[model samples]
Target: MRSPFDLSFRLKIPLWGSLLIVVTTLAISTSMMVQAYNDVRSDLVSSASSLGGTLAQTLFPAMLHDDVWQATEIIRASLHGGRESNVLRPELVFVLDREQKVFISSQPQTLPLLADIRQRGEEYRRLVDWIATDAGLETRSLELAKFHRIYVATPIVDTGAYLGTLVTVHSKEALLARFYSVAWRGLGIGLVVLAILLPINWFWGRRTAVPMVQLTNSIVDMAQGRASHLLPQNYTHRDELGRLFEAYELMVEFLQDRARLEQGMIRAERLAAIGRLSAGIAHEINNPLGGMLVALNNFRRRNGQDERALATVSMIERGLHQIHEIVNAMLVEAKGKARDFAPQDVEDIHQLLAAETRKCQVTLQIDSNIERPVPLRATLVRQILMNLTLNAIQASDRSGEVRCTIHIAGDQLLLHTENGGKTIPPEVVDHLFEPFVGNRESGHGLGLWIVYQIVTQQKGQISAESRGGVTQFTVNLPLGDPA
Candidate 1:
């Protein structure tokens, strides 16, 4: 069972619109039917009264001449003649004598009742009672035993003496028929008008619904951080929907910006972690890196060209030893084991990088352009340069040259290294400065990470570029007091 007040559209708009149309039309139709019925009934009553008046007028002279019986015959003839020629087909009419006896009538059976009732004084008394009654007019409608009739009565007066009454009865069927026919015609026209308007209502309903659907979908997409297009100008009607569309667009832009900011923060956290890990290894590796550099410098200064050629026989062995030591220290540091930091000769960093690249056999030309000493933990710097040079060497083909240019500019020391490597892949270039972030087979990727840590802690800068067939890493550090 449906509730009386469900109030849903399926039950309301179409149903109710149709119902209202029907009900209003029916109400108007009913009113018209009633008015038509009344007008037709009134017309019948007026015709009856006019006929009665005319008959009374015609009978008045006969009554005045003491020819009441002759007046009675004339009444009968007129009643039969009027009834036979009438368009409305009146039911009956009768003329009563001064004593209230029905002397003549269109229907003969009605006369006996009129005369018998008067002889017993019932008809005469009723007639006198009606004439003296408060009702000044004697016109009424009656429904009697399957017949509906209008009654019009008038008194026949001659020389101020009441002679009799003239009464006529008209059937109500014709008037009722006219009322129903008018009602039917009115109903048909109302339906035609409703039919013309329904389609227009449906079209407007759809137009409103479609834009709301689009706006809802767009809002859902924006909520999920998915890209969504704006509503069409016309669709975003200059009303509440338009304001909602504009607000949604602004929300999307704000969320996109916020998402970018959050992503950048996460990346910064990761890079900072990498730097901390690199700083850990730089501590342990600095001492061994310093020892190795001192050894290399001592050997280079004492050994002549021929002796160096002899040592070159064991070059691969020497290079492997130096790389093995630095790598062990790097691995330990990357694991976050606590270690040390100390002042050391900067040449150690340069020498360690050269030693590691022997595996790649790239010609490394290192030229130091310095005015004062650069203060940094030598082992850490060595690990930094070794990782950078090794990556560059791997990028270069065999026999490719790697150049290291060390110089001072203003109050800073710089290490600029370039290798004959192909241009960096754009996909990886964006993450190049990130830790664990390089294209190398033996790459733990802590190389640039350590470099970044040392440079950051010392308040310096570092950058890499792989363009024009050259992969270059540049390191900048503040020059310290040389005592």
Candidate 2:
């Protein structure tokens, strides 16, 4: 078990991002819902006041003339459903005369005309008590919510005549229903916004977290001495994370290159030690062989008369000569015989590699810009060309192209081989010419090493590059006098 801090940013970031989005959405949605409900509630209150005032104006002449028919008509006309307006219509509206009796009401059955207003219900009695407490010539409101209605008392008068009061009872149920409608509508819109935004938020969060996770994994792999996966770089994003990713990539490259360089130096040092020992051994064997050959010649000159002895001596001399030749090869360059580099040598290599290319179903392109023989060691140069071309062919995909190009670059013979193949890591490429660096079953990894030795011995340069699905090897050997 480990702390939550050990959790990968890849997983953590998306989870946290989703949570943040939900919280923000809820906050915004609740605020909007509250605001919407208040707006509708304000409109409801305004409608109650407006309806009360309008009814009072209409009922003014009715109250003065005792026209109950006109008063009832006015109250009935004011009753409207939710669809008719943004605010709910008043549930119960009625007119009161100066005697505090119910003159007219929309609900005539429950509230009889010309009845004492206070004696009808306890709610009415409360309204009457309120009127007596504050006798004013203006529209007033009383929110009797516990009684499930609001009492708006609007005074009726014509030119300062104390006519009557127009009291409208608005039900709490209607007011609440309108508020619920506004709240639901606001909530529906908020849900729609959440539906659209949530997925996008999640996806964006995942997109951002993916790269960070990959980068973190890469660092872990590098620390554990494993091949790191390549990060999906977003150079277009110039954020902090993007910069960090870029920096990490550059750091990895630098470290790999440094490691390769160090490995190459170590390999070179080992090879130098081996070369020194080999040269010494060759010299030691050569000195004894020269003395033995001289002694054998003298013995042959003195015993020529004995036919059997002479025949046996000749056979021994021939064996010694073979040994001498082998030693000579080991001492200087490993070649049957030395020859100058020529254009025909390129054709010979092409002929050899063509058979291999055919077997792999790969295309081999050999281009030589040589018009005549070049002053270089034919054996080693051909070996370098053959090895590089073979490696290119092996690296290429089936039906892919392995291109070999040869030409004279200044005073040096240049050999270039290329193939469309898997990219070689910079670390592998750096010490590629060192012995046993990329040792595998297919090769002893001595091909490039031998090539490197020959080039360095000939005062030449050789390098390799792999990029953009293309891997290339280039060798340059200085033109020499007859070997």
How many backbone clashes are present in model 2? 0
lDDT of 1 by residue, 1-483 (tens): 887456544335555565666677678777877787677667776777777777778877776675756766765665465444353546666666656566556666645535643453543355445544633434433334244555567777655667766666565565566666776786787678667766655565556656666677777786776856674574646788677777777887888888867865665567677556755666556566667666666666665557655577457447756666555534434333323222233456556666656877788777766534355444555666666666777788789998877676777777788888679886676577676676776766656656666666656777677778888888887755432
Q: Considering every candidate listed, which one attains the maximal lDDT?
A: 2
Q: How many angstroms is residue 344 displaced in model 1 relative to the true structure, after the best TM-score fit?
A: 36
List TM-scores for all candidates, in order.
Answer: 0.49, 0.56
Q: Which stretches of candidate 2 lie over 4 Å from their true place?
A: 1-33, 51-88, 94-138, 155-166, 180-263, 280-330, 333-369, 372-406, 415-453, 461-475, 479-483
* Ten contiguous residues minimizing lDDT sum, candidate 2: 227-236
lDDT of 2 at 115: 91
Candidate 2 whole-model C-alpha lDDT, 0 to 1: 0.79
Model 1 Cα RMSD, Å? Answer: 12.8
Please count the clashing residue pairs in each candidate, in the order shown.
2, 0
Give the alpha-carbon lDDT of every model. Answer: 0.64, 0.79
